[model samples]
Target: MQQPAVPELAHTQTRPIHWVLTATAVAAVVALSTVARPGSATAAQSATGTRTTTAAVAPGTTGVQFPLDCGPVKALVVKKAGADLDGDGRPETVAVVHCDAPMGTPPDGVYVLTRSADGRRPRVVATLVRPEDRLTVTDFAVRARTVSATLLGYSSDAVPSCCPDLRTPAAWQWNGSAFIRSTGSAHSV
Candidate 1:
């Protein structure tokens, strides 16, 4: 007797469906756990009166009230560099604030916040670089009251709109009045 023609079941296998459903159910459980179910971040935040993230710091700080309670804020970072840039005794704050850009571009601003000699009223000492779309400052460092940034896409055709290649470095030093371009290399932080 001739063997009956058997279609290959590789493409139409039914066991794979079972595995996929199982994986999906596992993922759903994990996702549900992260929500405000019981012991999640949302629940902990609600239990506490104060916002759990960055609180208003002590005196002489930039007072960066990270309002995490409202929701997930975008690209706004505050790096408290303990270096006393400008030869002041107090440390300065370096903040990367988000800038307006086109839909595909990512632009941000770097601000050097300095406090008065009275140790209060922190104000922006120098805006190292103004906000421009498609430009990126990958990393920054302060040495001898100087600021150098690992910048990308500031020049013409340096990087793409979204994915920036942070290879080129730029330096900015305080010229007694403002942060001027200086000579230095930016290392990845």
Candidate 2:
């Protein structure tokens, strides 16, 4: 047996619903902009604009007041030694200081901060304290992997004894990695 022929439906054109929704959204945005604040939008628009200004202070100096609890940092100095102390290619940094409390009382003892690289944050590698003798460091020098720190001893003016006016100077040397007391007669100035 053979099959019969089937009929087709009529074709019709239709506009997309998405296009109408998009036009409605654009119209709403325009209406909102017309009723918005006058300068608010303009200020936001100019936020990325370029402007010229000058800095009041130079680098490495504090411009604003800072807290006192940042710790006592009296003196700091760094120099490049000819030979490397840590076996690295870079020279060592010699930072000497007179700390406030942790090292000693009133006039604190001396500290040396050693570092392998220059312009880097120093770490406290060695500290010299003479609390019993009441000594405080005043100056220091580091050369040939040895550090000689100068200390000043204080004495009361009320005592009128034959003590030779105690102004003794002590020295400490760096034995490759650590500072050790040098054996010699304690020099008095």
Candidate 3:
């Protein structure tokens, strides 16, 4: 059977991100698997018995990568937007950080980082989009000083990857201090 529809985001501004976002999420999983982990567990099983083997990080060798340390970040994002969010015309960044252990669950966060003179490092000026409020991020968009994320219903062990059930389009704008989702516009698809 064919999959169900993924409703486009509320505003037309966010629609372009749909295909890009969906493909990225799927690609993230496939891409990360190829990166050979120096030391990880392996399972060996035969008709007789099953044995498991694991290796620890070799003293100084960093295991995965920075973000991969948590989980393989699919469509890894540590920055967003190429425009100056502060009107300083210096440009800003948006990233998904502080994820849960398994990652992609509620309680995750989206951070807005602004350019700093100390270096090219971007400082976290705002934290927005918690997992508890919405489902998994299906897509995202940034425009007119607003950040929009498209969330689709997902369960830990439920739901086939071929079909996601619902879509809630949320938009959050900087309110002088933080990024918060605007009221009402969520719907199922």
**Model 1 over residues 1-189: C-alpha lDDT tens digits?**
777599666657668788999899999999888884643222124465754542333223335442222234454553445355655334567666553333555465777776556645776666665664445676777677667677665334754466654456777665566667754553332
**Cα-based lDDT for every prediction:** 0.57, 0.44, 0.53
Candidate 1 Cα errors over 4 Å, as ranges: 1-75, 78-80, 99-105, 116-118, 154-160, 183-189
Q: What is the clash count for each candidate, in the order shown?
A: 0, 0, 2
Q: Give the lDDT of residue 49 in candidate 1.
A: 75
Better TM-score candidate (1, 3): 1
Best by TM-score: 1
lDDT of 2 by residue, 30-113 (tens): 999988955411112235675323211111211212112225553322212222344433344443323344342333344444
Q: Point out the worst 10-residue segment of candidate 3 by lDDT.
A: 56-65
**Clashing residue pairs for model 2:** none
TM-score of each: 0.48, 0.38, 0.44
Alpha-carbon runs more than 4 Å astray in model 2 = 1-88, 99-108, 116-120, 130-133, 154-165, 187-189
Identify the superior model by lDDT, candidate 1 or candidate 2.
1
